[model samples]
Target: MTVSFRDSIALHANALSLREKRNEILASNIANAATPNFQARDFDFEAELARASGPAASQGSGVDATLGYRVPVNRSLDGNTVELSVEQMEFSENTLRYQTSLAFINRRISGLMTAIKGE
Candidate 1:
């Protein structure tokens, strides 16, 4: 397979993994909403993907070594940082992106099969 196709497949796989992690983090945030002094944690998906794929300096050209950071966006009086609205929004967006990535991977596989069969 060509380098571009291979890269595409790899990227999609990374995306799928990232999406799974994001889902878990979001779920955690939602589940902790009721807990007092709970600090909301978030994953930097873009940064994670960059690191997974390659170094921040070489991010565009290849794999980046930058580790994704999890930060709290807001703090509450009781130290609770989980924001229901924000978590829900991120969850929805991540879900959409995951679906898109899956679709692309499936299409690529289909094309490869067609070519292999000389169809």
Candidate 2:
């Protein structure tokens, strides 16, 4: 039998990439929370992931609708769409998911190593 690291780690690897991107986006939203007219942006993680895993998936998600600005629960006076609390919550969740993806990839690699060792 052949060991395909790429296949085994593909999902987790893609998740890590997306999670990192999400983390950055969330951080940016938080950073610009006080900036007037700054709209908070985020991608549909599940949709993006499905598209990414497709056979002919392109790196550029294009100008598609997957990316969107978050709607605030309460509108601000300065026209800023970034809700600080929401952004913080999203960042924290993304961080946790990123850690989870890392753990899954690590376990997959360990299992592959064990299989390769034939022990």
The top-ranked prediction according to TM-score is: 2
Task: Compare the candidates by lDDT and give the number of the best one.
Answer: 2
- For candidate 2, what is the TM-score? 0.89
TM-score of candidate 1 versus the correct structure, residues matched by position: 0.78
Give residue 64's lDDT in candidate 2 (0 to 100): 30
Give candidate 1 misplaced runs (Cα > 4 Å). Answer: 1-8, 55-74
* Candidate 1: clashing pairs of residues: 54-63, 54-64, 55-63, 55-64, 55-65
Cα error, residue 18 of model 1, in Å, equals 0.5
Model 1 lDDT at residue 100: 94
Model 1 global lDDT (CA atoms, 0 to 1): 0.75
